[model samples]
Target: MPNKKNFFLTCAVLAVTLTAGCSSGADAETSEAGVDSVAESVGDAKGGSSKSPADSDTGRPRIRLDTTQFEEIRMYQGYLRCLKDHGVPISVKGNKMPEADPGTLWFPNIDVAEERPEVEKACLGKKPLHPPELDPQKNPDYMDDYSKWIACDNRRGLKVDPLPDGGGWNYKPGVTQPRNADQIDKECMIEAFGGE
Candidate 1:
């Protein structure tokens, strides 16, 4: 989930950016299956040594998997975030950059087969239990008609940025406007995202 502003922007943007909706299927059972498959491969590759050099000091090995490239690929980020949020100890290896994919996540404490369901239910559910503000689709306060509404911001003496077609508005970085920015932002959102 994203913050309020980001959430609204994403809602507007996603209509353009994503051609298909996503499916969230990771659960304890699926996680266990994935872990077993990886474990077998790793076991064979390193004589069943699950410990990597980084985690060897702890004597508790971790299961790592190469995941997708885009952090905007919310499915993986949401899954990992859900795992951590629910107190499942996880370690992400490699540099995390939005543009870079194939990062790894390691589960240190989970007995992949036994705890997979708990993780799925707690952190891998259909919605992944994001904070309320992060999900604009569920937020009662979110606005929608950004195209016509942005004009209101421009008229209010706010230095507003343009919205891309089928996308949301973003302020040009480092730009300044009125001192009452907080209120102005709310007004802008209301105007931009409100019904036509």
Candidate 2:
């Protein structure tokens, strides 16, 4: 029997090369697509590292996520790192993201977002890092908490409001000069990052 690992590798390589070969004409096949095209459509979540998904510019395609390759990528540190390396933006259904890649926050269109000097500068060309393993997204309480935080961050012009200078539990705004992490509430970072 063929080695399973080698089999998958061969499949991926053939897919990439064939894709490149077919598109050399610069005309994307407009017909209905298969799994390869589906990867192209998902915006190539290959953002954690340098390698981009094939045909990233092609219109977005819906991903089944049930595929073996996707399952591997979802669990692969290197793949998530590639997403960050390439500056591909990631956006999750909620803030829930891969625990293995902490620094890799979810934002849409990572490729474009990476072009922004800020992210490029922030990443410092270093290997992508996943955020700390957060509370389980599957938990009902965490889901509720996630929604609350999302809503709170959605509140326009959310300023950092820490204790002693503002409301106890309720954050007060208009506190000129938002200070560092030590001076702000824990929620400030989440808010500043747009609740990502």
Candidate 3:
């Protein structure tokens, strides 16, 4: 039950880490083009926020929408299907999305550089949008919201120790994470970050 945000962050971090090892010759341009396409679509949306910060690399404004777990799963499944359809050799089993875990959807042997263009094409509009309020660059109140999330986690038996100066937090050193850590994270995230 890890929150959608955490799951998305985990997947993004994993993707970046894995892709960093591959050669970045033409893939970089392809990836940027995909990002630009998403930015255009988001910027064109009706009633979208005008306060989105511009990306440093592309100089395009980033427009992100708050999304729920179900929405994210649906989008991810579609992207996976698209990849399969585009001959990326990924297997999409059933309709259910995989659990939000690091190794769950990981394909270690996949040649990211070779497949990157196809991935970009398939996932053009399928990237999970970040909520602006949760983005530190966009929201002045990010630290406050993060602190609330930390407090919520602690109250729920996660025992997180927040770093000083609005830095991030880590689990209390000796305390092992509970078996239901994901559930706690999910509930606390909703409590701290979800708009009422």
Candidate 4:
């Protein structure tokens, strides 16, 4: 069994892998089962909701995960702005938002655990909603879907190999990825995993 620290690290790496569509130098030995375990642990930690807030008709604000990484970064900037406006003392570097701590993706870095409630209340509507297709717990077909995502990338001329068993992909070692690779990745991700 993976320890909590390693699991959180895997989650962080997985997030980067998903966004970048390439290995972030994480262990290639990390298995699909390990990812499943992490997803299950996260679901358990969050009380195992049967329906995500996006799926529920509960009158909650829900942002889709169908956007590009650039768009998502813009949203994160808004979240940081909201936190600072709410007196969270978040630090920003030039125009970029601060990196999220592992396992607390999208949440601002608050030093005190007791401040979470206040942060949550202040940033209620700005939280990013994970689409079911992109969520391992919600989509048991996540690996297969990722394989299709690789196929989509290949179709778009990205010439990358999907990591064995579906964790991520890597560019051909000697080949230079295109200058517009980011745009291609955004389009492929939307086609492969974006939710309606």
| Local distance difference test values of all predictions, in order | 0.38, 0.29, 0.44, 0.45
TM-score of 3: 0.49
Lowest-sum lDDT 10-residue window in model 2? 19-28
- After superposition, candidate 1 runs with Cα above 4 Å error: 1-5, 8-144, 172-175
Candidate 1: tens digits of C-alpha lDDT, residues 1-196: 2222333223212211221111111222223211111122236654565633222112111111111112223334445555676677776644433233445453334443366666554442322222232234554543334544456656765555654542335554575666654345445544444332
CA lDDT of 42 in candidate 1? Answer: 35
- Between candidates 1 and 2, which one is better according to lDDT? 1
Better of 1 and 4 by TM-score: 4
Better of 2 and 3 by TM-score: 3
What are the RMSDs of all candidates, in order?
17.0, 20.3, 11.2, 12.5
Task: Give a tens-digit lDDT track for model 4, residues 14-84.
Answer: 23324333211111122111110011121457566454332332332232444433334433444455566
Clashing pairs in 3: none
**Could you tell me the lDDT of residue 67 within candidate 1?**
16
The global Cα lDDT (0 to 1) of model 4 is 0.45
Q: Which stretches of candidate 2 lie over 4 Å from their true place?
A: 1-137, 143-173, 182-196
Q: Which candidate is the best by TM-score?
A: 3
Alpha-carbon runs more than 4 Å astray in model 4: 1-61, 68-70, 81-90, 93-126, 194-196
TM-score of each: 0.31, 0.20, 0.49, 0.47
lDDT of 3 at 45: 50
Candidate 3, which segments miss by more than 4 Å at Cα?
A: 1-8, 11-71, 86-89, 93-118, 161-170
